[model samples]
Target chain A: MKLTESLSFRNIKGRPVRTAVLIALTAIMAMSAICGSLAVMSLRNGLGALEARLGADIMTVPASAVSKQDFENIVLQGSKGYFYMDRSYYDKIAEREGIEKISYQLYLASASAGCCSVPLQIIGYDPDTDFTVSPWIRKSAGGELKELDVVVGNDLSVFVGETITFYGVTCNVKAKLDKTGNDLDTAVYTDIGTIKRLIAASLELGMNDFKDIDPDKVVSCVLIKVADGYSVDEVLNDLNLHVRRTKSFKTTDMISGVSESLAGVSGIIGILMAAVWVLVLVILFLAVYMSVNERKKEFAVLRVAGASRSRLAGIVMSETLIITITGAVIGIFLGLLMILPFNGLIEESTGLPFLLPDTLHIIICAFVALAASVIAGMLSSLGSAKRISRIDTGVILRGDN
Target chain B: MTITATGVCKDFIRQGKNTNKLTAVSPTDITIEAGKLYVLMGRSGSGKTTLLNMLAGLLTPSSGKVLCDGEDIYALDDEKLSRFRCEHIGVIPQGQTAVHSLNVLENICLSYMLYGSLKEREAAYPAARELMRKLGIAGLENEMPSALSGGELRRVAIARAMLRKPDVLFADEPTCDLDDENTALVLQTLKETAQSSTAVFVVTHERDAVGYADICLNMSGGSIGKQ
Candidate 1:
């Protein structure tokens, strides 16, 4: 008899109710794994798009602090002459060999009322070369730079067509940008000259906000974009070394540093999922082991019928492959069905986009599950098949009868 | 051809205590001609079943060699010995146990398919159909083993054992659980199959089976024929 034929017949022999229960468990394991994996993929994709859109590719802030600290500190600490960047140096570095382009925007705000009047970041950029603000600016302005006009980001768009006073100067929102689902969505965009005028005017009038403003301040910090072939780390190292020579110029004080939390989140999820996979492995092991235990008589009969050890093991493995593979395929299908309906909702909430599993993931998952099932079945059958092989058939006949 | 065994001893450490070393048919030589019906009668735990197992190549004797056509079966390795039994010897264990998954027809068909020559198998269906008809189980061929009664199952088991036209047949209690009618029918089938030059060895406590035997070996004292 063919090894597969026997195994197939055996796998299907149990009562319908019993078989269904076992298959359902396998399906759950498969579906749960796929769901977890897809969640990871969706989140990572969202975070990636967000990161690329954010101006923080590498923030230049005081080296001691990371994250929002640089933006906030540069605003708070005025006379300390610390956290300061000469905004004019941005244009000079834009001409550097390895640098692509630089963007510098000063956050300008004025106290209005309550929480609704939170200090807004005012982004300033050169019209021709800025890719950083181009997305939001294009959306809000309806066109490229028209001198003196300003664009607002998504969060600020609710106040569209409304004018807000800051430092006693009123700037009307010319247009509102589509939501990028990031902090930039809350900021305002204008040209470099417009922000410089606001800061200078505020300082000259000695407005409460302008009393602490640095008159000689050029740009808070330059946004450095390295050319395609040049390394950012190498450029930063060179720039820092050159900038450190001046007593008042603090290269370390200006650079914010790299953020690794996104990568860290992915790693943590991976470890947690691995632990879950180990538990699934244990379940798989038990299922295979139990099937072997139940089929002791069958294995013994086949062995006495002269089946070799390898062929007997083949029988067990064939059954496992059928079960595991069938379960996994059904699982992916069920998982897709489960996640797809809520896909848009998740994307909306998490700021992440999701993609359907492709043919490659299906093929690879099938191959992996099959291999795992076969190996697990082979291992589980070891003791039972051995016992069958060594059974004294004459005694079994006597005892059994 | 006939099977012969001399000075066979088999030991067993039964139940972790009893050192039951069975010297079944020990130093006793017997042979029956081809195409004969033979019976061994014994009580429970007697060595008659063990002796039949050795003849069927299911067990190895401690000392003696079982020769069929002058070839010692025990000398062959496990696979070769199993192949020999599959081709040349048939066995019916105690109780009319059936391979329950396969229906009556498939059960008989599989037995012949395992041992029949390729050409013989090409014509197997007709032969099996004829056997079923003769045994009055032709209509039950599609029924699973569990659906059959004790008597019906015994007839089916006998049909399966005789499927390959083996040279030697070993049956343990072929009619043990059958009524008078089924038992007689079973003996009649054995007698008919023996016409093809197959020597049938039957182990039973019942005398009805002994009446069909050309020779009787009564096993006692872990030996055969009372010395």
Candidate 2:
């Protein structure tokens, strides 16, 4: 072993209680940093996903689906369900003075029994009028989607060119969307013709629940883009007054509660991380101080044995660094163990989108956390190192008798 | 080399209310030459250790200069003085000076390692084992200081000091807590060390220490006199 390393190892090994306390405190600091950063990143990604996937200023749904509870479940919690509004609402909204664009969509759910990997929501849109899903489909799928071609969400198990069956009708997967960490992740997008054919197939198989409903006359929702000179409230007021049995909602307002909840959670985690840092720093300082105080005579002996003051200080600093590095490794390992494997469960329980950042992002965070731990160790040990450097060797050695 | 102390004294500031200053050691002149065992005899607080510390370059005298080979030792800065002591001076402190974590061999090689004279443990092990065997601790190289007797720890301290074969050896009460057999052994070792052309200064109240001295001095009430 190198001289400094051997000396530091011997010193740490000699004092078990001091070493253990320092390691434990540093571990707590690192663990808090990792977990807190993970949660904050997850929330940030979730909010970004919401912004990207919603892609519309306003949505008009059936009046029965206007409850705040249902709105939160569908928008924030990614729940799988379907509702409908009359197709006439889309025509009226599109002709309004302030409307820039309008598109209609139909929603349905697939059975869990051998349909796909899981029970999922399916959305069908008109390619000619769609302003949202069509742009992404064109960008990712390289062209317009045909009658039987479907784009799957990031969470689906199927790949491109694979087939997924819905009520005895199978469709080809053309492209896969990027992860949005929201309900869109579990959705499949196809043209309205496929949905109509699936509906007809269901009706033929004795699943006649849709026999009274005409696919051409009904839509689940209408997405609107207000004109440049008009505000969303102006269009919303006009739509609510002119349209019957339809409710308009701003996409931002629909998920404002979730945004507030995320802010609260992030604030708490920030405070918790700060508190852990303060506590760890205090404990580290105290532990090092006490250990140094107790070893005054030993330091004096080293001085008389021809050890320079800087060398003594280096020993103390080296011991602290070793403990900090050990703690950081263990703490980060535990953090990764708790987070990576159980991310889905955490998302379900928290009712928030939980996405692990990519490998490079995780690596950067771990490096930053480890660096912070090293800085903490250095800061906490500074006083002790200075004291060791300035100790009066003659007095200590002579007085020890 | 010869260590010369010219009217050196030490004064410490007392902490109590009058803020009085206490003179721990009165000014005294002494010369410690190589190839001699010099014993300074004093009771518990007679300034023997203070004078020894001054001579060993561990402390600065308040009044006079401690010169080694005609160069004032106190003129060197802390760093240079530390290097000088590492290469030229060795001190066995009053009691229990072993670093408790290191075993016997590591303890013996510690001084050489601290001074960077030996870069690797392998380079230090042969010398350390030779010293340990000379001190009658041949088979105890792997034993911890905590498991050793008082005499054994003292021998380890002595081995550490002598590892670099310094010119001057200053031992403050080297046999303070030892039985008759260990005391004799320790004194005989110091006697043998002094005869090997090193200046050995031993501060002790033990009468037996005087028998091993080539020159003896008595200390009383912060003053020294020839014995």
> Highest TM-score: which candidate?
2
Angstrom error of the Cα, residue B128, model 1: value is 2.5
Clashing pairs in 2: none
Best by lDDT: 2
Instruction: Give the range of the ten consecutive residues with the poorest summed lDDT in model 1 chain A.
Output: A73-82
Tens digits of per-residue lDDT for model 1 on A73-172?
Answer: 3421111122344544554555556776666545555344332234566666666556676775675567775654677665564475677554555677
Root mean square deviation (Cα) for candidate 1: 9.4
Estimate, for each residue in B119-215, the C-alpha lDDT of model 2 and write its tens digit: 5656878888888887777899999889998888888898888888889999988888778887888899889889999999999989999889999
Clashing pairs in 1: A60-A254, A61-A254, A61-A255, A61-A256, A87-A218, A87-A219, B7-B27
In model 1, the Cα lDDT at residue A258 comes to 16
- The residue-by-residue lDDT of candidate 1 on B1-227, one tens digit each, is 78887666666554666766444445546675688888888777777777777777777776677898888888987767767776777777776556555667766655443344445544676777788888777788888888899878877777777776778888889898788887888888888777678898888887887667777878875677821
- How much lDDT does each candidate structure score? 0.61, 0.84
**Candidate 2 Cα outliers beyond 4 Å, as residue runs:** A1-5, A16-21, A68-70, A76-78, A202-214, A240-245, B15-18, B117-120
Deviation of model 1 at A138, angstroms: 14
What DockQ does each candidate score versus the true complex, computed on alpha carbons?
0.18, 0.61
User: Largest DockQ belongs to which candidate?
Assistant: 2
